[model samples]
Target: MSRVIHVFRSPDRFIAGTVGQPGDRTFYLQAIHEKRVVSVMLEKQQVQVLADRVGAMLDEVRKRFGAPIPPPADEFTDTDPLVSPVEPEFRVGTMGLGWDAEAGSVVVELLALTEGEVDESVVLGDAEEGPDALRVFLVPERAREFVARAHSIVSAGRPTCPLCGEPLDPEGHLCIRLNGYRRGVHIDPHEAPDSDDDE
Candidate 1:
């Protein structure tokens, strides 16, 4: 089948957001242009990496190409939640980022997951055959805004465990450092530990 590329050259809004609680959240990257909205699902790590890369790309563009990137702002202006419905067209498998020298814009491409291996060319190129993709181009200032919002969304997840550096669950957390003991749950010193039974 032919690839479906949703291109938002001058998006009205583009942001990263999540649904559900901290422990079980679903991360998404959404782009909007007029009434058109394109949402793609991805892991939290993907969001973090994307944000980091975009920031770095902006800096590199400024240094190498003399692009005028805006200074980092104290806070992000677009802190709103994801667009309504929150329906994701596809789960992102591979992502691509590039700086468009002519346009002085950051180009972000999110390709849909596929059963087979993906063609790298499809990432930043307009290949006739490839997985679906959502492409958004943002100017330096708007790119900075996106990076800020993405960082905030990623850090809004559950607090990490001090010992293991893993996310702590509200119900409980099993800390490997404590030899599989549940963290944050009180254990009486006098009480005997439960033993495992074998069939």
Candidate 2:
């Protein structure tokens, strides 16, 4: 079945945002152009990978085409939060990214579950066909904005234990680096423990 595609060219607003706090957060990518708005839900890893790729894409664009990159907007974070994101158009099943030669912009395509291919005998869990995709085009500066805000939101999650390089909860963590001996002990990731030299 042919999928419906919402294409936003040089979108006025394109950003990645989260709905909840830290550990329980839900990630979303929103694209807005005047009255038309398209929102989609995706995983945290997807958000992180997208940001990294977008940043790398910019560097490649510069070296390859000498594309002029606009100065990133003064504001890194969204001035206005996710708009009417309660009902996402779809939960993204797959995503495609590329540069548009004609438009001279980066295009992000988000796909949702494909309806036509569903079959009774085909085993529900595994399917060959992917989801329908929406294409969003953004200028260099706007893409940079997306990467910056995405990084900010993704990194704002739980603090990491410096010793074992693992996430630490608000209450603290039972650091695995110390092994089973420190099972009950909570290590505060943010605080620096002092050392005593005196014998």
Candidate 3:
């Protein structure tokens, strides 16, 4: 089947959002242009990396190509939740980012997941045989906003364990430092542990 490419050149809204509670949340990258809405599912780590790379790419563009990249705003205006019906067209497998010098825009390409390994050449390229892709082009300011919102969404998840740097569950956290004995214990890293170190 021919691949479907959902291209949003000047999207009305493009943002990363999640559904459900913290630990059980589902991440989605949604792009909207007029009435058309394209939502793609991806992992939290992917969202982080995308935001980080986009931010870095903007900086690089400014340095190398002399692009007029804008700094992140004091506050992101689009703090609203994701659009209704939260349906995902596909789960993103491989993502591509590039700076369009002519347009002075950052291009983000999210390719759908496949059963086997994906060809690198298909990324950011016009490959007829590749998987379906969702492509969005954003100005420097919009890109910065996206990065900011993405970081906020990621950090909003479960708080991390100060000791092991892992997420702490509501019921309890099984910290590796405690050797699995203290299943439901919440210890402050600043406070000293009990004298029973022999456990």
Clashes of each: 0, 1, 0
Root-mean-square deviation (CA) per prediction = 7.9, 8.0, 6.3
Error of 1 at 70 (Å): 1.4
Ranking by lDDT: 3, 1, 2
Query: Per-residue lDDT for 1-199 in model 2, tens only?
Result: 5446777876889988889878788989888889888888899889999888888888888888888975444358465788874568888766667888788888887777554653433221223444545688888888988988988878888888889878888876888888846547568877857767776
Native-to-model Cα distance after best TM-score fit, residue 116 in candidate 1, in Å: 1.6
Per-candidate TM-scores read 0.88, 0.76, 0.89
Better of 2 and 3 by lDDT: 3
The best candidate in terms of lDDT: 3
Per-residue C-alpha lDDT of model 1 across residues 112-194, encoded as one tens digit per residue? 99999997888888999999999999998998999999998998899999998999988988888999755487778779676
Model 2: lDDT of residue 176: 83
Show where candidate 2 strays beyond 4 Å. Answer: 70-77, 113-130, 183-199
Error of 3 at 52 (Å): 0.3
Preferred candidate (TM-score higher): 1 or 2? 1
lDDT digits (tens) for residues 1-199 of candidate 3:
8788889999988999999998999999999988999999999999999999998998888888777788755468899899989999999999999988778899999999999888999888887888999999998999999999999999999999988999999998888987887557777887966686677
Output the worst ten-in-a-row residue range by lDDT, candidate 2: 118-127
